[model samples]
Target: MSTSSNSIARMWRTVLPRRGSVARASDRFQAGLLIFVALLALAALPVSAAIGSETYVRQQGESAQQVSERSQVAATLLADGPDITVNSRAGVVGNSRLTDAAWLLPDGTRRVGKVVAGQGRLKGETLTVWVDRTGSPVDPPLRGAGVVIDAVVLGLGLWLGALALLALGYRLAVFSLDRFRFAQWQHEWFHQLDRKTRS
Candidate 1:
């Protein structure tokens, strides 16, 4: 038989309580507990997915609201951006650098503010900036991709945490069972020795 089939057969023999089975009661209990934990893990899949779906829906709505409240505008840099070497030496990995810039508000008024620009950009260069209705620079709106990623991370993290707990419980159960089996063996050994000495 195949290795997988042999393993399945062995598991079944260990879990099934049958007459004349050489397996001890503790062994059968451990096997049964393992099967139960596997089934519980499978059952948690749908629950985790549901939680993820709910989180995605709620965050997607929030993202949509943010997009509506935010607008992107072209900002003219007023000063030279940080040098590329300085940015790299400062452990800044991305192209972003804080620099003074100016952009037009919705009311046609010009607003000067510190905006994030690419490193090595010279004065008068234009870059896209996200701003609120007051023409104040703000972080970019959350994207759909970010919402999905958050949901996936939360769902997977919860599932993994649950698996860790289940594994811990299994380990504890096995430890207790091992202790019980050892004690039983010691008692049987002494009983056999006593009977031999009496006879």
Candidate 2:
């Protein structure tokens, strides 16, 4: 069995093309794939990065922090809601507020409320809650959504390119085959024609 396996393996190697050719093809495909990926990555990267960076300072992380800190301070400062006033200059709302903020109720134990901030405008006053610690996190864990879109776009490009390349490469690879077949047919046909002419 081992002898047969060895013989078959040797035969396979003898019949197969050079290993270097396969490696070269793999390298070419890798280079092409990198180009395809870089285009998408370049477009998505900046937009997504800008959004996250802005959100950290302006929206998600900071808003919560400020509100929480102030709320803690407010609870300690005034005692009740009738006179509790957060001012205009405090700036942004929503998730950007500080994380750790809880109210000290009159009794003793800590009570939790949203970071309470009122936006001040020249016209009027608008109060906003920057952080709702009550709710679950807004960020999702695993994503299967835009990936499908990207895959479809990238896949279509790859498939179409592959088809065109195959068509071209097939013409390249089989030029010799076409010529060999044509030569064989021409030789046989001419031999018959010559015989007929002589007779």
Alpha-carbon RMSD of each model: 3.0, 17.3
Best by TM-score: 1
Ten residues in sequence with the least summed lDDT for candidate 2: 71-80
- TM for candidate 2 is 0.24
Query: Roughly what TM-score does model 1 have, to 2 decimal places?
Result: 0.83
Clashing residue pairs in candidate 1, if any? none
Q: Write candidate 2's Cα lDDT for 1-199 as tens digits.
A: 7997895554444444366544333334433544454455555545555544443434444445544543212222111223324557864432223232344433455545434332222112223322224331222222234334444555455555555665565455457555766787799999999999999
State the weakest 10-residue window (summed lDDT) of model 1.
Answer: 85-94
Compared with the true structure, the alpha-carbon lDDT of candidate 1 equals: 0.90
Q: In order, what lDDT does every prediction score? A: 0.90, 0.44
